[model samples]
Target: MNPTWNAIRSGLERGVIELRQTFTTAQDLWGYLFPAVVLLVVMTVMRDSEVPGTGFSLGAMALPSVLGMNVAYGGLVNIAQHLAVEREDGTLLRAKAVPGGMLGYLVGKIVGIAGAVLVSLVLVLVPGMFLFDGLALTGVGTWLGLLGVVALGLVATMPIGAALGSLFPNARSIGLLFLPIIGLIAISGIFYPVTSYPEWIQWIAQAFPIYWLGLGMRSALLPEALVAAEIGESWRHLETLAALGAWAVVGLAVAPIVLRRMARRESGSSVAARREKALQRVA
Candidate 1:
């Protein structure tokens, strides 16, 4: 067997093990469920409200958009946080010492994070189906479109996450990203129609994958009439694909260089210094 293939297989095993652990550990389980619960509560509060200019339930419309946002969050922030924490703790350095270990580590992360995202999707979706109305889940087209968007979203965001993780010095620095992410979500129309936002805000939202992912998911799950609420009264599938593809291209092109540089800089002394800082904080 090819060594790289063997490493990937090992990574797959590692990812599976980690995924199982997440279910078993109380902290991990809470991490997985907390977001879904909050989103569901928000949706419940909006269940009676109608989407602007439409009779459709606002909660129902927001459900898929929330799912799309979750995908973006998992592929980007979750992975970035994990990379930063692991690098500080010497996981990346350990991988650097072994042939193909970095490849294995990365593959493991992709698999694990993707699995977690899917689980979160199911958690929100199953409950959402019971609580919300007007979803178009029965059609084969809906499932296929959803699957495509998810795959594209993961490809588009995960490498950027890795690169961002590499750029950060520690887990604390990743918090700075949260403010921008919230701003993006606000402008991306996750809870409302983007068509109603200012033109400049609309343009800013369209430039990011979060907006496209939400748009794609809405295209999959909402009735055609809901397109009236979207920009141009269309799903804009081609634009969604183009924007996400551009991010994927740029992220994939840049991640390896950044990750390699980060790995090269890792050493026993650096990890120890980080550990000492953490201990001092705790003390």
Candidate 2:
């Protein structure tokens, strides 16, 4: 077998192992369910409210948006957190010590994170289907569009996460990312319609992948009439593709350079220093 293929296969196996571990580990299982449970509670509370013009349940409309948000969160924040923590723990340095290890490491990270995100989505969606009514899951087009949106969303966000992770000095600094992400969720219309927001805020929301991902999911899962609640009153699939594609192109171009530089900078002394800092914090 080719060396690169071997590395990739090893990475895939690593991902599978880690994914299984996630199910077995109590903490990991909680990490997976906590957010889903909170969102379900909120959706249940909002079950009676209706979307502005449509008679459909507001919780039902919000369900797909939440799924979209989860995709962005997993692709961006989860990867960033993992990379930062692993780097501090000397995992990246260990990978750097081997010829094809970095490739395998990255492949493993992607596979593991993507699998976790898919499982998380299923956890949310299955309960949502029973709790809410009028979800547009009838046609083949809906499923295909959803799959495309998820693929594009991950492509657009994961490299950016990798770049951000390389830049963050330690796992503790990853908390800074949460504030902005929460702010983006607010503006991205995860809980409400973007059309209800101010014109400028709507534009800002549209500028990011989160909003488009939500809109894409909504387009896939909601009735056609609900488009009245969206900005431009259309799905804007072309713009969604263009925006996500642009982000993917730029991130793919930049992440490798950033990650390579970060990896090059890693050393025994640096890892030790990080460990010392973490110990001091614990003390």
Q: Which parts of model 1 are misplaced by more than 4 Å? A: none
Q: Candidate 1, residues 185-273: lDDT per residue as tens digits?
A: 99998998888899999999999999999999999999999999999999999999999999999999999999988888899999999
Over the full model, what C-alpha lDDT does candidate 2 score relative to the true structure?
A: 0.93
lDDT of 1: 0.93
Give the Cα error of residue 36 in candidate 1, in Å: 0.8
What C-alpha lDDT, on a 0 to 100 scale, does residue 76 get in candidate 1?
88
Clashes of each: 0, 0
- In model 2, the number of clashes is 0
| Pairs with steric clashes in candidate 2 | none
Each prediction's RMSD over C-alphas, in Å, is 0.9, 0.9
